[model samples]
Target: MSRYREIKYRTVTSFQRRIGNPILKRLPNQTLLETTGRKSGLPRKTPVGGRRIGNAFWLVSEYGEKSQYVRNIQAHPQVRVRIKGRWHAGTAHPMPQDDARARLKTLPRLNSAAVRAVGTNLLTVRVDLTN
Candidate 1:
């Protein structure tokens, strides 16, 4: 990655980790993706923006594999998503081949706009809800 992109990634992710995530995840109505920590053997919930379609929930990972939640998903595909204050079990799949930019168009507008503006290595993730 270019130096600029690397710096941007660090800056954005640092803010999200330290400030944004803590506040957002606490919101009662926030959409959340829960994944088992890759090394900690604990649950990690992240505030996300996405729309549930059919038996699946779709989201774009702005940081792709570098994102902690994505790494956790790689370690454990089984996950839970809290959508509209209800939790649903699912399997997380990171689609590197999918066109994340196009997929974003189909998601929540505010989030899509933010993702487009800040994302560097965008990736699409699908959760097949089982409950």
Candidate 2:
């Protein structure tokens, strides 16, 4: 990765982790992706922006595998997602072959735009909802 891109990733993600996530996670309207902590064995909920299509939910991780939630998914593919204040069980899949930039076009606008603007290593993820 370019030095500039690495620096930009750190700067933006730090702010999002410290400020944006804390506030957004509390909003009932905000969609959430819940993953089991890889080591802690606890639930980790992250405010996310994505679209539920049929029985699946799609999203792009701005940081790719580096994102904590992505890492968690790697440890345990079983996950839960909260959309419209209700929760559903799902299996998470990382689709490296998918065009994340193009996939973002099919998701919610504001968050997708932010992800495009700030993302350095975009990666697509699909969660097949079962509940």
Candidate 3:
């Protein structure tokens, strides 16, 4: 990971530890997802924007496929989510190629200039949650 990203992750982790919540409070239509480590079984949480499509909740990965969180979700789909302060335990379902591409079209592009400045790929991943 880039120094900037490492620092950001540390800062966020500190914030979550001290405040018991993420700094990015209201994510408009987003939700808070808490996943357990597949091995350690420790809880890890992050805020993600999502849309309700029919009965399922769709979440786009703004960080990319290589993210540790993404890998964790892939290892174990069972997850706990907080939407508007209400928490629910569910399973994560990675969107299929076609569905991911379709959902990616709806997401905003990464700020190339900012990414260049930070030296990291600002790609996001797309996932679905089923309760």
Candidate 4:
């Protein structure tokens, strides 16, 4: 990862750790995703902002496609997501172009400053959760 990306990731991780899950619950479009570490096999969790598209929740790789979380999802799709303190187990699947495009149109717009600082893309993936 580039220096900028690394710094951004660390900042976000720190922020989430300091804030805990209540703030995540108030945010209508956020989810806390837990995935097993690829190397250590230890549980790791990260806060992600997501949107509901059709029957699945969708997450965009804001830190670019090369993010570790994205790679982990690809390696092991099985994941656990927490929304409003409710936990749901799921598998993540890459979203198709059409679905991505449609979802992008519906997503809440962010200011240019936020977009530039975060360096997120419009590419999305679906979270197939178990009820």
The lDDT of each candidate is 0.96, 0.96, 0.58, 0.65
TM-score of each: 0.98, 0.97, 0.58, 0.65
What local lDDT score does residue 109 receive in model 3, on the 0 to 100 scale? 43
Question: Residue 83 of candidate 2: its Cα lDDT?
Answer: 98
Q: Candidate 2 on 25-95: residue-level lDDT in tens?
A: 99988999999999999999999999999999999999999999999999999999999999999999999
Error of 1 at 96 (Å): 1.2
Number of backbone-clashing residue pairs for each candidate, in the order shown: 0, 0, 2, 0
Candidate 1 vs candidate 4: which has greater lDDT?
1
Pitting candidate 1 against candidate 2, the one with the higher TM-score is 1
Off by over 4 Å in 2: none
The better candidate by lDDT, 3 or 4, is 4
* Consecutive 10-residue window with the lowest summed lDDT within model 4: 111-120
Scored against the true structure, residue 82 in model 1 reaches a CA lDDT of: 99
lDDT of 2 at 24: 99
Model 1 alpha-carbon drift over 4 Å, by segment = none
lDDT (Cα, tens digit) per residue for candidate 3, span 26-131: 5543467777887888988776656555545566553455456677888888887776677776777665353444464454344233323432333434344454
**Model 4, position 45: C-alpha lDDT score:** 76
Most accurate candidate by TM-score: 1
Q: What would the per-residue lDDT of candidate 4 be over residues 34-78, giving only the tens digit for each residue? A: 877788888777766665556577666555445567777777889
